[model samples]
Target: MLYIQEMHEGMKVAGIYLCKSRTAAVTKNGKNYDNVILMDKTGTIDAKIWEPDSAGIEEFDALEYVDVVGDVTKYNGNLQMSLKRARKAREGEYDPKEYLPTSDKNTEDMYKALLTFVDKVENPYLHKLLEKYFREDAAFAYRFKTASAAKTVHHSFIGGLLQHTLYVTNLCYYFTKYYPILNRDLLLTAAICHDIGKTVEISAFPENDYTDDGQLLGHIMIGAEMIHDTAKEIPGFPKKLESDLKHCILAHHGEYEFGSPKKPALAEALALNLADNADARLEFITELFKANMQKPDSEWFGFNRLLESNFRKTGDLNAL
Candidate 1:
């Protein structure tokens, strides 16, 4: 099968792909078309059935595996497809694993590394809370490891939540060594549990879409609530400690405009917020390079909306 990332202009496309989305549209001349987004593990691409009402176009919708025959074309510097034929793939006709994106790192290894940090937490209440979710709660542990950090953006693949958590935790660990003022246990605990609410915010793979709770409350609020509820169950948990920890999660985004419910109030909260931003931006840029790496001759990849600037590779050091 041809992955979306491997596709180029003027290539003929024929194979099964996951239909991530499908919508009807009308052209200026009133011609009907079906705007579709096709997906595979590598990534997704835009597709269109220009003649939706014409014969040979099969019935299918979002979330179904589709068999398509089309010509790859370029529109406004992006690759798109002009489909001639399409149909809903029969059950067992295609492999489901090929359609979902997955992380390159092993999930188990990442989880174990996270537990090492948990072992380091000296605060009894915080340590117990970490164990309640990561070590003792079998179902939550499985979901946390498997869930994506977001529906899109950085770390949007399987094992993404765990991967992001580990990266953030590593950064937090370094902060504890360099900055003696920041509470090590609080910072590390906040980092590990930062995006745990994503397990409920975004559904598991195949769909990987937002749930009702995700749409209504979002991961930030959901996560804070989860932390509060869990802490209440632990005996002798301090009230001030719980508030401080929740503040870190709520303000991790760092600003109100960025979806943070509050700005960082404590030194530890500030450090966690900065670390989260750095890791997220780094991952986002890495994904940008990977997606556009197909163009070997081009130096400039054009402007990135996420980064708010144009980007170019520095090329190999050996060549220099």
Candidate 2:
């Protein structure tokens, strides 16, 4: 099992990988080729079949496990594969678990930790709302547990939504302690529900891409709608409280250009936004460093579009 992260330039790639996508394209010289993305739990790498119609290439499609033979090469600072032979893998030929990226943390443990926060919500209506999804709904619980926080960015793995929710919830909980002006219950409740729409926004792996709703409405809008629909079911749910919580979800992105339907208006909404952004950026950097572990500390990875800066590892204190 040669994971994508372990691959290097000039290496011969021969393994079963999930064909994340496949597209046909024509070269300027009028030659036809297939653009493919081969994925495993470690990550994804771009691959190309220069001779798609040749005898060595067999029928395969996106989301199918494929047996591939290729050579690894560097292109524009990223690793890519030039595939020689490819075929649809038999069911027994690959483990489905190996093809999906997953969190290092335990999913059950993270869910339990998230539940503790639900327990801490002293407000009955908010507590019931949390219980309705996290404790009572079996189907939603499974999707929430398995869903990724994003299609490509931070926490993009199985159990990612749960892991990310816990991190942001923990951060909001801490913020409540330091900033007494923030409403503990509202802030924490909003944190727990902030990304709930992601369960529907991104389809489950190995097809962890945006759903139709995701492309049209996105997680913020979808999440606010989920909260509105659910809160309506809770008898005696306070209208003001429901509105505030939904505002937090709609504004968690904190800015108009960032896809937030509304900017943070409440103190708690602002706190939730800060916490969400902090966790996302920190996790993004953590994953970035992990992906570039093979490079020396002094070498700049290059300009990252998300961070809008070139990044490199800092010197180790122990070495100093």
Per TM-score, the best of the predicted structures is 2
Q: lDDT tens digits, residues 196-219, model 1?
A: 889989998878899999999999
TM-score of 1: 0.94
Each candidate: what lDDT? Answer: 0.91, 0.93
**Clash pairs for candidate 2:** none
Superposed model 1: Cα runs more than 4 Å off = 26-31, 91-93, 315-320
> How far in Å is the alpha carbon of 252 misplaced in model 2?
0.2
User: Could you tell me how far off, in angstroms, the CA of residue 185 lies in candidate 1 after the best superposition?
Assistant: 0.5
Question: Of the candidates shown, which would achieve the greatest lDDT relative to the real structure?
Answer: 2
- Residue 16, model 2: Cα distance from true site in angstroms: 1.5
Provide C-alpha RMSD values for all models, in order.
Answer: 2.4, 2.3
